[model samples]
Target: MIPIQLTFHGAAGTVTGSCYRLDIGDRHVLVDCGMFQGDKTIKQLNYQPWPFDPRRIAAVLVTHAHIDHSGLLPKLVKAGYAGPIYATPGTSDLLQFMLPDSGSIQEMEVERLNRRNQRRGGGIVQPIYTEQDAQDCLRLLAARDFGSWFDVTGGLRARFWNAGHILGAASIELEVETGGARPLRLLFSGDIGPEHKALQQEAMAPSDLDIVVMESTYGGRPRPKLDDSQRRAVLAEEVTAALAAGGNLVIPAFAVERTQELLADLTRLIADGTIKRVPIFVDSPLATRITSVFAKYLHQENGIKAGAARPFDGGNLRFTRTVQESMQIEQVTGGAIIIAASGMCEAGRIRHHLKNNLWRSNATILLIGYQAPGTLGALLEKGERVVRIQGDEVAVRAHIRKLEIYSGHADHDELLDWLTNRLPIHGSLMLTHGEPDAIGALHASIALWRERAPQVIVPKLDETYSLAKAQPRLMKMTQQSRRLDRYAETEAISGHDWHNDYARLMLQVQHQLRTAKSDLDRRRLLKKMQRILGRGAGTD
Candidate 1:
């Protein structure tokens, strides 16, 4: 039997609901059981049963605290996985805010579904995970610091490095040994951040790896580039323009970083008296709690630790903790600023606020994050004339604006550079966590990579590979010089003519090469085709 195997269970070909499983002999580990967000088709996958047995997992290793990457932990526990879940201390703190809030979302969704079910004489519906499940899940979490190696499975040692994608975000590296011998190193590059973010430290790249899994969220398209100064200038201008026109600016942001960053910017503007200190309200209870977490960790921030005072606590910054307080935001009348979540406007207090203010011509909706393809946030960002909220259609008469600086993921060119700098040529690569177009673009880009150096593989969900078993195919193709041998046979068979058939065969070969998961597979197939075609016996 082979020593090690890696299986991708989630985050393969789609951007949300990330989960992966690793096995070495009798030991097993699961990584990042996240909930799927975005289109209803993708979100529905979250309700389906897991592909593997949760009970068999020895432990759960979380990469970060983002809901798309950590939301399903409670559900895993509820389904009877009692093992310790490991993460950095910062992730643990964020989970304290994320888990219960996710539970509340699940409860709310289930309640709404049940009421509809009753109306249609269908059975009562239950939440996928409850707050109690989240509490139980928390008891099992063991927070560890980065840069320290810990024994993870029977023959596997693991460590984390800062990903800089979010506070306490990490990229996981695992060294697996089978039968107490033959070490295999695999690195999981969780969501990554660019070098330019304000609060995060710079991202780190490792020197070498046997297999590397990378995310490709922005691989297909380039995000609009603007320097930090330009971003801030645009934001300030939008705010002042809205206020000058007697409009209140409403921003739907991720509670952790985007909300706080926007608030910090507003505080700077108001303190300098560049803009009026209009009433600003944070209307999501989850955001309110997360803001407290951020404050507690202020010393951990890059520049803020040097005794830089935070403006989130006072001066027009108000946190609304109750539904009533959130609803009261409607009475702010004019020229106030409001921030809320879920950033996509799919749920949470933002929907309530959007429904109340969307019809008003004087209101402005500001988007600060990546809106998934089928989300309400995407609709608004695309200038849809109407959006449905809570089963009622609301006219999108409000001014819609965007500030792209709020993105947490790295862009296209950044992804390629990260891969080239971090991984040795011998290492294999897996591209995941993107839509089909993004993944396809990255897949093509990696081919150019394979032509020069290193083995690359774009893995798919449920594709299993024996880590040790893949070495020979790569060795044979590189050492034997099969292309040279094919050339020699081509010279001997040059007189034969079958151009049309050869073209058809070549087209099929190209398709297989494009679809093959790894360079090793491509090499193997090329060698086989060389033999089958009698080395250029036909012309194209």
Candidate 2:
């Protein structure tokens, strides 16, 4: 009998690029081929070739339609994977709009880079996947309803359970039959949702598992159990504060769930007269389409109950899809709410809004979702007084408010409860989809489950585990050995980065010296270099 095996392709020690593989005998199955986001290191990881042959993979199971979980499917299809990609109906619907949008964004980014490369006489660049590639990949998708058992190749049975993280999100349950080896079961928690989401259901409980894979995105901290009323109250106050200041309330939102949720909250607030009726502009085209989908398919639509007023029916809401409509938003001097994406202010219409509103003393920039490190949103969240936007430094006079209560992922305590609520978890627990500190913190929390001393495994990127040979045992690594491994990697990366930065600074100094037309200009450049050198030395 062949032994079943598992491999981690991505999201091993990071919050994005979630991919996993299960090998059975001669065939393989995959779950989630997503794009990586965040700092340069994370984005660079996407440039690496796929670890395995895409053609060899028999099937793919998508938990949801978030870019970090499903963005790379078109690339997989382009790489010759002719297998069925399974997803829930809602996820499928979202992907139809989302994937092509991703392709378009890639094309735009590549065009921008090529223009720069052209000036430098560099090679031409191409997008990862074209819109046509995404359209081709859509033909391979098969929508499966939640709770339906589906069969994969190589005699494996898989089931999808609602994750409640977003519309059509699901947790995957796989039943593996390896030569009648007692038919083992495995559960993959595909980004578990927090409780009491405005438009989402709670994540289903996990049960009857031999081995379980979990996400630890929020493991390092816990979110307070803020209910609907509490969230509404806070949102009203934030909006009121923005309104009183007599400037726009700018919200950088994820086009999917976050946009829908915010619209629902706004509708309720307006209905109850908690805040003045303000014109709310939905600025992202993708978000506008997604909102329409929710209105059509979900019926009740984003916590706006059956009898409640619709998000756009109040006549104060506007959908800006064209450049003309988007630019017109700048003309609004005060008391308007502008919602746009890319959520982290990394790209798209949000940057324009930030450039306009961030300088206003009365403007309130409300961050309602997670902002990855090195993103413009993170810089603002960290209280950077001035930031560069579209080649200009803009003063950040706007008040910034982060309402993490709007986050959809399960937090530390909620993860614990989600685990404890399930029965027959007599198997090893492996944590992924988080940074080392978060994974480590979550691993330590397992000690409280004294009834069974759980064997916790935090697998590194691309690590493999054999299910046939040994149980998922505790990794008893020596502290010295681990320290060396960690430090060796850090030292090498830091050394390379230091050299590059030093070279860039030297080039800047050389250019300024060469361009100096007068003694005053030379002295100014000298003073700037001194300040730069002093700042660099302070870090050292």
Best by TM-score: 2
User: Taking the tens digit of each residue's C-alpha lDDT, what string does model 2 give over 98-158?
Assistant: 9998998888888988898899999897788988899999999899887878897767988
* lDDT tens digits by residue: candidate 1, 1-540: 545667766776667778888877767798788887765545655777776678989998999999889999998988889898999888898898789888988898889978988999999867878887887789988987888899876777889888878888889988877443446777888998875665566667575777787899888666766665566677788889888767678888888777877776777777777778888999888888877777877766421221238747565788988878877888875789999988888888888889888998998888987887667897788887766677666778999988767688888877877787875735577778887678778778877764655565655545565677434121112322221234322321221124323433655677689899999999999888777777568532
Prediction RMSDs, each to the true structure: 14.7, 5.1
Worst 10 residues of 1 by lDDT: 472-481
Pull out the clashing pairs in model 2: none
In candidate 1, clashing pairs total 1
- lDDT score, candidate 1: 0.76
The C-alpha stretches of model 2 lying farther than 4 A from their native spots are 299-312, 473-540
Q: Residue 149 of candidate 1: its Cα lDDT?
A: 94
